[model samples]
Target: MDNSKLPINQIIARINDAAEMAREIISEANIFEAIIEGFNEAEGTNLKLTDITNLEAAQDWIDEFLEKYSDV
Candidate 1:
């Protein structure tokens, strides 16, 4: 698809939409991890976590989760 034909406002709007989607995905991943940890704790079992691609990816998720609560 040739996006150059679109207006500048349309391009900016698309960028914003993509960013919002990325933020939501990061937030959801963080929430999922928390829920899994809580369930494991409640069951009195060891919770093993797999490594992400790198530290940056992990930090992104943590940041988004913290932003949701305004506390980190």
Candidate 2:
């Protein structure tokens, strides 16, 4: 975690790794938001990320949504 003490190459490598991780996290978040929005549109309801209390419930909702509208 102490990138300051690392060599230049190591520091660059760590920075690159952190950037990649950030990109992945952002991508996943975007996908999750899109799925939630799609589900809300299909169901004619307005829901937000705050409405889902836990990851299991979110996954369940996504699964059900996809099962019901896989053709789209």
- Say which candidate scores most in lDDT: 2
Model 1 whole-model lDDT (C-alpha atoms) = 0.70
Total clashes for model 2: 0
Off by over 4 Å in 1: 46-72
- Per-residue lDDT of model 2, residues 1-72, tens digit only: 676788999888888999999999999888988988988888898998778889898888889888889987
Q: Candidate 1 versus the native: TM-score?
A: 0.57
For residue 3, give model 1's deviation from the true position in Å.
Answer: 0.8
lDDT of 1 by residue, 20-50 (tens): 9999989987876785475456557654446
State the lDDT at 53 in candidate 2: 86
lDDT (CA) for every model shown? 0.70, 0.88
How much is 8 displaced in model 2, in angstroms?
Answer: 1.1
